[model samples]
Target: MTTALWLLLYGGALAWLAPPVLRRMTSQGISPQLGVAAWLATVAATLLAWLAALLMVIGATTDSVLKGNVVTLCLELFGFSEHTPIAGRVGSIALIGVATLTAGLVALRIGRCLSRLRARSHDHARAARIIGKPTAHPDVVVVEADRPAAYCVVGRPNAIIVTSAAIESLDQTQLKAVLAHENAHIAGRHHHILMVLRALAATLPRIPLFATARHSVADLLEMCADDTAARRVGTRPLLAGLSALAGHPAVPDGLAAAGTAVVARAERLVTPTRWYVQWAHRICLTSVITGMLTTPALIQVLCHH
Candidate 1:
């Protein structure tokens, strides 16, 4: 197959097909970190494949400008029968402009998002301190609020907030679970993880790849924390805490917890990943990651076709 068709297979079709499979793997009760890695691998592969295709398109256009015959060659290669000289030349030039414009816009958007997230993180850390007070837990702070609220603000002196309602509502074991859960957030460095992915997503909000990546990573991070907390304090403690905090407010941007996945986390803890499912996740992800790492080299070699 020509490079264009190969690009479509890897970049266009495979990108859309892979996300669901990754999501399914996450639900298999396998290793959450591995699931997160697979999600990252999938998105990186899709982005790299699309980027390779874009470079190829631009290179072809450049070739047409200097080499003269590249336009006619590509038109015939792709079976474009409306292959007038004027049409071929115009198409290549137009593609060059479009690719340039797209790259510029994506760069600008990513820069703006990173700037905003930095500012927000600063403000969020400040506000969390004002609302909460120092507790025995060096990392955690408790605030007096009637409504239930629990969230963490990232960076040094990270805030893991617990509301009056949360403290009053939960038993000693459940409260320990909450602390363990928030502590897991700090240890896992989920805030930094999500922030980086969010920056990438901001660059290409129109693409499903970014959205799927952000969600999948965030969810897996939460699961990883849950696993840690469970092993430390037992699953029942985290499970009860999550149940009581079901209707609580959402965490600040860049923070993750058992907030959204209360039911899912509970269910997962009840069941275990079968050996077959674990092996399947490993096998499939290894295959995709290998393909992702190698495909660009192969595509580059065949690009002249």
Candidate 2:
């Protein structure tokens, strides 16, 4: 009975958690910082769920080994003589089996996603090569696209591709700023992190938390890039670069372009407000903390059986 209950709890948690993470990853046009934060949250939540499941498995195994003894011990400890019903025992076992299967499936899905992503990365690198000269740095690449497009193509040989158009679009200072931002994405390996979170969400689509995390991380990643660019080149030139690129038709989806969030980024740059950005930052932090705090409670609930 305890085993079954443990399984149900863990299985339910996994079922609940998976969807949100997946949704977050697939959602459109999320900023970098928000995306990162959301992904981090999803990871934290998934880890906690995994840990809880592990503990439940341990508990179930122990209970199976000492079924009769455990029931007797429980009776003695609680001064009760009621034996668990046969149906309850069977149900518990079923729950345990289901939970184990769910976890296994999730793990398998994540592995498959990683493998696919690796292949995709190779393909992206090949495509990037078609465009122009490859840079020595693992993250940044100078491409020869006709239009000014500053974007990061994330994969195994994750490359930050910037076009000659981009070079000509902005002054030398703005170009430096643009490169700095792209470099930050590469240096931070932001794409890999986003991919993992997205995979987690795909594996478990029922978890709203994962969705929230994905969107938040996407937005945050952009913000982080913006921050990096702002630091390298003053906010004014960065703003100019962003404005110049905002309406460019060449910018593609899934690539971090110079004009990705031009208006919002510009607004933030011009009227810099710690209150606004920090508010978003706090939302990400709060979500993480809430997940962390709830984990112990979740574990305790599992242990009660």
Candidate 3:
């Protein structure tokens, strides 16, 4: 019981502390990819710590047949006391029921979110294909809208939708840069990342971390795509294309070329920071990830025995 309490505290502390540190590290020029990894790892570690603590609590109270022996053996190995107070046993049962309910709700919420997102994406892509003209490139199509929009819809054959106005606005090189950005989004499977984060955020609105992380990861993924596009087509062209498409409206269930943190991304390209491959940045990222994950595991084990 004491060990479980400590583990719960540890998880809470990590959930509260990690976001600021991860945000700072990303701002300090760690690559968006590493930033995403660090954030996701922190979230996972916190959840794992809580889950392990929950299992420990249940093990202390449960003496049922099939699972009881295994849990009892593990608890004994960890030096957990055999006898739980009557009150503690009752509390553990309640906690188990609550956890089960919460898991079911989260699963349902995520399922609904995924279903809606996929439907919207498919519908939008189908509409775009019907109305938009094909380009020289196999992956891109130009829509006849005056509003200069460019976003990619994920599907069987991922499609990049660019407005005719945008095509007219940008030079050939700039246009290619925009296409490259959309291509990067598709190639990176960024939609999957956003979908998971967004679903979690929607499901756990009370947990500010999920909401914060969803927004942060969305921005970072945009930066990741930006970096790829910049490398494919030079920064100058990419920057120009982004400028041309500034204030672009985001499409539902779509990754827009210039829809996320445009000013920050542009600044980054203009005054490039140290790349993630540098030893210094790598060390910083490695340490953050290790410390965040290891601390929780250590607490779960060390606090028990």
Top candidate on lDDT is: 3
Assess the local accuracy of residue 58 in candidate 3 as a C-alpha lDDT between 0 and 100.
62
Output the worst ten-in-a-row residue range by lDDT, candidate 3.
Answer: 65-74
Error of 1 at 130 (Å): 2.5
Could you tell which candidate, 1 or 3, scores higher by lDDT?
3
lDDT of each: 0.73, 0.61, 0.79
Residue 91 Cα positional deviation in candidate 2, in Å, after optimal superposition: 4.6
Residue 303 displacement (Å), model 2:
6.5
So what's the TM-score on candidate 1?
A: 0.81
> So what's the TM-score on candidate 2?
0.71
Residue-wise C-alpha lDDT for candidate 2, range 112-229, written one tens digit per residue: 9876765676677667766767665556667766777787766555666777777678897776777777777777777777677677667766666555565556656767877888
For 1-305, candidate 1 gives per-residue lDDT tens digits of: 24644675677655667767667767544778777777777777776777766776788777887776545333444466454443266777887899889977877887888878877886777777777787887767788988665667774567787888888888989888778877888887777778868998877676776778787888788888888888899988878888887876576563535476677778888886788977887787777678766876787576554
**Which residues of candidate 1, in runs, are more than 4 Å off?**
1-5, 63-94, 199-203, 252-256, 301-305
Worst 10-residue lDDT window, candidate 1: 69-78
